[model samples]
Target: MPRVIVVEDSPTQAQHLGFILEEAGFEVVLAPDAETGFRRLNEEHFDVILSDLHLPGDSGFDLCRRLKADPVHRNIPIVVCTSEVDPVNVLRGLQAGADGFVTKQRPPAEILGCVRRVLQRGCAPEPSPSARTRVTFLDQDFELTAGREQLLDILVSAFEDVVHINAQYRQSAVALREANRKLEQRNLELQRSVESERRAHEERKRAESHLIQNEKMTSLGQLAAGVAHEINNPLAFVINNITLLRRDLGYLEAMLSLYREAIAPLAVGRPELVEPIEEYAEKVDLPYTLENLGRLLERTAEGAKRIRHIVASLRDFARLDEQELKEADLNTGIASTLDLARGRASELQVALETVLGPLPMVTCYPARINQVVLSLVTNALDACKPGGRVIIGTCVKEDGVEIAVTDTGTGIPPDVLGKIFDPFFTTKSQGKGTGLGLSISYGIVRSHGGTIAVESTSPGGTRIVVDLPIRPSPTAAP
Candidate 1:
């Protein structure tokens, strides 16, 4: 690996530069100032040296000149890391024998490339005189005959050498300028290419995500219809059986009443006969049964009706039968989602509460809205501890409804919160979640011309609020 020395007075800046070089697979040595930089150079050779432009004493230009002046260290390439951005300062550094100049503000890659090029070029091969040169003059014989021939020949040859050297230097400088211009242009093009590629990648990812969501919606549409039907079928018998049981209880009550009336007269006619009847009534708890039977039957019927309503809700929320946008009461959608989640919420011992405000009907895909609600509610439930509670509520906004699902669990951390809506991101244990719930919900809300936002703090819980337009956006897609 190449060894690099970073001479920077600021400890922080030196450490940063050292880290960059080290991570790039270069061995880095640090020097706090020019004096220390020279001390390290004497101890061991380095492939390259990077020095900051500004130092307490002996600035980078002075160091570059000193290194170049020393015969032993003259070959070591030095790159100036400078805040001095003016072209004149750069030329001054080059004149002092610095191999390259890099602005401190340039990214690490740019600096690394600069150093690499300096190494490739290898300390600007010290310009040397050609070993052999052929110089012929047509007037050589006449010059030899003249008495001043030797002086004339010496002057001409000296002029030729100076002219040749000047032409070579000019050519080298022009080539260097062209190379620098091309490097600048290439860097700009590379940056633009990177940006364009990033945007294209994002668009492709979004398109793929949309395709996946569409597929999921299709499967959900199919599964929801069948599930609703299956649940409703058993619920129908339960409702009917409860109704019949309630009627039978009434008949049994009436018969018992008549029997009581007859027995009362018998007891009054013969006090001795009342003992056995009283003992039987006490054993059966007849008075208690008569008092509570109607209430029990009424509650059972009401519960069965609720089960039926829940089944209907499953179908409505899935909207297996509806394909177009329609005006819907947001309250109804919230209610259905709550009912659908009620069973799981009970199992998890999480209390569910709501405070729905009166709101105007908003045009939307009702089933999709229900799906979003169900997802948000269950996500809240998942976040809750056993004794915690989740609140699902809605209120009227300026021109739309705001649905919020808040949970009593510890709030999401800032880092994780940003990714909660990213597709396939989840904090749940494996197999317990698919990680697509919040992402799909977000897409649904966005497609309806709405926004979903979250507010949270540790131990204070989290509330995700969704805002929608009063009417569906014309640009919304299926």
Candidate 2:
């Protein structure tokens, strides 16, 4: 019987796995922690080892590393069984020499399947099918009676050789079957490669488009700022003239009012009053209009101020420089990114909330960091439906700062979640998104000696967390 070892901390979980393996017709051995697990391995050889990542003392990863480093146990295939299904966890498990990784949430059938495959591989030897078989024949027709007996013995020996040859032929046939299976697996891997390449090509195109859009926006912002400045210079004179004209009109109206008052008292006679009123109206045409010229001037000034404000916003959005490192406040960068993406939030009708914590000034490229924050926030907004909420929080940690952007939006699909950070991989409609935002953000954070990750639930929402170092290390460059 094939022997299988399971290393887990939980009694119920361990027993359940052991029962399943026993039901599968394998001799099962159980260890509750890494210490006992290592002892079990030293005491007996096992076909496969199923280990939980989180054990009592040593972690599954550490155990795997130790096992893989041991010459005696290195050939034993290890399957990591854990509740953690994050990409990082999966990656770390593989890095630690786990031959297979299966989440505890997976169906028992899947776990059994992995166990069977690993044990089958462990028990089987590599097949060599291509070697040719050799055949030799001997004839016994020499002596009469004694030669007849010799001929029979020779024939018997020939028969024995024939049986041996047949056994070798069967072994060769089994080897061929194994070779064919391996070929099919290779073909399947090739197909997956082709598919991955196709996706990569699509991603490249999306990245190009995203870069083009950024460039266009930058150009437009510069143009807008120049036009606003030019217009402001001419508008300043127009505003000044409008103000002076209103002031002169006010003085003229005041003088006319004084004249009217003086004339009203002096001209008690109807003929004199009529003549004075006609003369005043002819002098200034004050009764010809009732519009407030001062109000018009005020409205003009307000419009100009609004235009200037818009221009300033545009300038801030477009400001980009060569990647130069400097000390910067992360909170300021977050605020600016929010301002830049305000339009996107408005379109989605998503409310944005920020809880900024006290963070140390970090040396990083301000523009690049801003771009990263903007990309993350934009992605969060895009994921959300109308009336959804996005929360941006930041805090200082022991070695760095953590920024988290969370959204109450449609969660990521499980199948495509792993490829989210791959360039050009998008879940949006064609022409809607280029899908390079997260990839670029990931790159920027890495450049700053930081890490970025996502947590999400299907049909629920997603949260992106970024941890950045406070100071850029010269030797630890990204």
lDDT of each: 0.80, 0.73
Per-residue lDDT of 210-281 in model 1, one digit per residue for the tens?
778778778877777777778778888988888898888889988988877888778878868878878888
The best candidate in terms of lDDT: 1
Question: Model 1 reaches what TM-score against the true structure?
Answer: 0.58
lDDT for predicted candidate 2 compared with the true structure: 0.73
Compute the lDDT of residue 239 as modeled in candidate 1: 85
Regions of model 2 farther than 4 Å from truth: 1-160, 163-310, 321-323, 457-459, 475-478
- Weakest 10 consecutive residues of candidate 1 by summed lDDT: 141-150
* Every model: Cα RMSD to truth: 19.3, 28.3
